[model samples]
Target chain A: MYDEPYRWIEAVANRRQYLDDQFIHGSPLVGISCAQGVLLLTFNRGTEKIYEIYDRIALGGMGHPADLEKLRFTLLDMAHVEGFQRSPSDVTASRLLKNGLAPVIKPAFEEIMRAPYIVKILLVELGTSQDRDHLFTMDYDGMFAEQREFGVLSASSSSGDRLSAEWKSFGVVASLSSALEIGLRLWGVASLLQDSSTSPEVKIEEKDKPSSTSPSETPEEAEVTTRIREMLANETLECVLLDRESGKMETYRSLGQSDLQPLIPTEFQPAT
Target chain B: MGQQGDFLQVLGEQGYDVERVFSSHKVDALHASGMVTTGTTVLAMKYRDGVLVAGDRRATAGNVVMYDRTDKVLELDRYSILAIAGVPATAFEMARILEHSFKYYRRSQLQDLSFEGKLRALSTLLKNNAPAALSGTGTVVPIFAGYDLHDTCGKIFFYDILGAEFEAVEYAVSGSGSSTIRGIMFYLNRWSQRTMVELDEEEALTLVLRLMTSAAEFDSATGGIDTQAQLYPIVKGISAEGVRSIPVERLSQLFSEKVVNHV
Candidate 1:
């Protein structure tokens, strides 16, 4: 039996590349978006392997690939072993957050530093179970979070640091939508910085803009227009925000097309 | 005597008549009802994620509606639902009794009974009523549905008058309006592959109501949605969150939107 088991392990290792190839070719990204923000998560249950693409909510590294499977096991344990009669929804985010389990998976900030891609994470403790609780986020690495509101993760280390400093300047926004707007603004700025460093055209677009004020617009409108133009120039790097109030997660290609359009000047139209 | 025996005795004392109706006999009975005092339609279909149970609000006593506010559909638990047809009064009475018993059991035990347990209990109640129903009084038939968490998908069960149950793999329909509803469902089957998240609860309820409305329009025994009275067909969902009734306002909005689009 032992010899057979060893051979089985070797066979699996040898065929691992083929399995991975099959998964990579078969799986596709599934995303959800609405008025608030957008979330993109990948599913590859067929092979029992999982990976995290982008996460800013800080609930530990996108959790293990087997986390969901383990959660299902926990649910079965609760129902069968522990005799806890409760709906699966009752065992989720808001409940975990209320029980203060959000911080259990501490921010492994060092792991994030080694990653090639920038990371951002938001975590809300939903509730606790006798055995486990839940941590929900808008984006976890590449895993999609579908709850109405509670937490968000924004990308860009330098921009994130700057936004954290400026966050204190803005008054407390208790609503999820407001928090998402702030996060989107921070993400937009970070994306711009990232694009300017990698692309020559964005740098030229910034340099060509006139430093002097336009003659007709008010100061606020002019500022809004400039910001919109800057965002539009880096439209490929979109900013997503989650509005918990409406249960909508929306993605904005440029600030001009965002809900803040009323603040932008009429002359500054987003390029479709 | 035990409570079960007492229950059976009471059922026998009541002048209820129940008899097994095969598929051929059911069709004959449908013809005999003069198409007026027809059975209401009850339908349950299993989708990829969960079960969809539906029923029209119309109950006829000869040619007229016995009640407009009738809800012939019920969610028995988070993962289980039931739809009733046959004699309106008898079916409603049976439903209320079963609901009360389930609630009492839950409250007493401080835990929910399993889906199979619930079904077994219902079967017992129907079997006990066999003596009275064998006479000529009335009978109740129901279609039960649930999401078996262990199974990780939806399941549906249909019952005969004698309480003999059969599990339907895809779809099951019963009652006076069943043929029409089934006709509409057969056409909609092509799109049933879509995930539950892709279709909001509001949209799902509208689809059910549309099928019901279409059935009512063609079948004299089935009633169309009463917009003037603000009464709509009953729709419920059983998922990981438990059983929840769809809001009437949402149903009304969808109905209006569909009507506008059609016109």
Candidate 2:
């Protein structure tokens, strides 16, 4: 029905609205760069949401599992081919997103006849130094941004902003445990933001909110912590690290439950 | 991709040919000159803890030494090692492919490639290079060793130029100096007080150094320890924990104290 130019624009806008609705209940992911390396943490129902794409590159995403898997394989292929043709160090998050995934994703999204990918991905590349670490977030519509220190992918832009603000106050942590704690705390905030029916278009002024740097949690943070505790009983906490100090060819490793046990906040631990 | 966890298949689809890349004009020129760069004398044996793999630091071209600091034993992943005894160019390329393939399979499938799968992967590469191998241009006879996490023990497998894999119960040897090392190993295993499996880490390392010395005495291609330059063989251990390289410092101390004085 999108025979006219205006109709095609309207169709694309409608597709965006439909995608937003599908992502209303999407799980949130937090990727933080620290001295240890980069930690990507997400609370998922079962299937893995974090992956190692290359030696130094990792991926975390929220959306349709099928779409996510497709995107993951595409990235894996591109990264390996690039690494083989050129060099392993040549594979970077910026290059993969800008030159590889973005171009592929943008077209499917614009083509009304083709099924657009229902996914949002955060790609992290561990640099030689902590400050040099690169993170990129790609949207379903093929929009992406290069970030430093932290990257967040959530249901709504507002929730992403809330998580970003929370992460900024905490800053890049030095240890995996400390970074994990911050990631969990940000996950809670993202849950609160996604749970609330507030319009993402409405920007809540940061000054109006309680100072996030305060030691105590906001009321919403407390509620989300309880929510997380209950959800943890059945859901699995997936965390993968691109460890700079691994000193091995492949640096990606998924954290085991035992590894995460002590680091998990007492308030959020699921009953064994 | 269709969930094909085969990295070489992925590479093949992208037009990668190990034989074509290896058997080129440079190789032809080298063949005409009778100087093909070859790596020599790689061996692996079971020890008390796990497996110890060693390779002498030499790359040869006919009678001339092409390079002295060549590392023939390559770590394919955390647990797996590839020790080649063939054309250095072809062997190095195989190692690189294997390194990428293991990581690619693990990342794509979200699980480590099984021990049997790892073995087959190597066989497949060798089989694909049959043309080059049969032509005497890029023949690679390799010994593979790794800690089998599932089997809970160290295992060694050796492959012929035609890609036939055979499990070595105690030890395996390859390369130009292999005949001398192989003959000594057969005698030692039969007459020695302790088998190769019963030796401790230090004993295993000492035996390897002695073996290399003996191999070099008989085979010119095997460059034994370069004491003048303080260069020793590359020795790596694979165990239940993982893989670790024996530092040059430790090798030095062991050579000076244990191998030299027979302590």
Candidate 3:
């Protein structure tokens, strides 16, 4: 039906709106670089949203799981084939996005005849040190932006901004434990911000806001922490670390609940 | 043509014709002229804890030593290693293919390729190189050793030039220098008081060093150890924890005290 150029443009706009509606409930993903390495965190019911795409590269998505999986494998196929044809060190986040994912995703998204991919992707590459780390974020429309220390993906731009603002206020984190603390707190803020955007009429349940433990947490952030703790009752946090000090060729490590127990605060721990 | 996890098929789809690439007439001419460099003497044996894999650092073409300090034992992944015994060019390409294959499988499938699957992947690559192997242009008789998570122990598998795979229960050896010590390894494993399985890491390492030394003594292609240059064989241990390279310093100390002094 989108034979005319104007019709095609309108259809594409409609597709964007549809995709936004679909992702209104999408959980936000957080990625940040620390002294130890880089980490990607998200809370989910069970499925994993974080993945290792190569030796130093990782991927986290905040959209349709099936679409994310397909994109993940496509990226994997491209990465591994590129590494095989060229070199492992050549498979950087920028190259993968520029020459690999963007090319494929952009065409699919623009083709009015074909269904578009409704996923937001965050890819990170751990460098030799924290300063050199590369974090990139890709929107549903194939537009991508590169950041040095932090990247986030969510359904709403407001929530994404909230995550970025929270990260900036936290400053540089030297240890992974401290990064995890800040990441989870930002995740909490993003989730609440997304919920508020989706349903402005409804307010977050006013449960007993847990005593703010961190000195940096604002009153609003503390309220978000309590709201997230309630979410932890049914949902679990998934965190993947690309550690620089792992001393192995492969640096991607998934932090399990037991491993995160000590790093996670008491108020945030999911109920057993 | 193969499954989604088939790396060779993936490469094939990308215009990488393994058979053609390996069986090029130019490479055939080089092989006939005896200019194709070949690595020598790689061995793997089961010890009490895991498996010890060792390979001498020598690449030779005809009568000339092309190079030393060649790493024949290549770590393909966290748990697996490939020790090659023939044309380094073809073997190195195969090594790179297998390395990417494992990672590709893991990433696409979301699980590590099973040990048996890994064994077959190599077989498929070797089979694809049949023309090169048959023409004596790119023959690679390699020993594949890894910590099999399902088996909960280190395992060794050897392959012929034609891709036929055989499991070595006690030990496996390949390359030109292997002939010098294969029978001795068989004898020691069979008749010695401490079988290959019973030997500890140090003992296993000492045995491998002695085997390489003996192979070097009789085989000029094997650059077993260079005392002046402090060059030692590359030794890797595969256990449940993963692959760990035995450092050069440890290899040197063992070579002097155990292999050289016969302590």
State the lDDT of candidate 2 residue by residue for B89-114, as single tens digits. 88989998898888889889988999
Quote the positional error of residue A108 for candidate 2 in Å: 0.9
Pitting candidate 1 against candidate 3, the one with the higher lDDT is 3
Largest DockQ belongs to which candidate? 2
Model 3 over residues B5-95: C-alpha lDDT tens digits?
Answer: 7777888888888777777354467775779898599999999999999999999998889999899999999999999999898999999
DockQ of each: 0.03, 0.63, 0.56
Q: What tens-digit string does per-residue lDDT give for candidate 3 at A99-147? A: 8789878888899888888899999999998888999999888999997
TM-score of each: 0.42, 0.93, 0.93
Judge candidate 1 against the unseen true structure and give its global Cα lDDT, from 0 to 1. 0.48
What fraction of native interface contacts does model 1 preserve?
A: 0.00
lDDT of 1 at A47: 37
lDDT of 2: 0.86
The alpha-carbon RMSD over the true interface for every model, in angstroms, is: 18.4, 1.4, 2.9
- Per-residue error (Å), model 3, residue A202: 6.7
The C-alpha stretches of model 1 lying farther than 4 A from their native spots are A1-272, B1-38, B131-136, B190-203
lDDT for model 3, on a 0 to 1 scale? Answer: 0.86
What overall lDDT goes with each candidate model?
A: 0.48, 0.86, 0.86
TM-score of 3: 0.93
- lDDT of each residue in A47-124, candidate 2, tens digit only: 789988999999999999999999999899889988987899899888998988998899999999999999999999
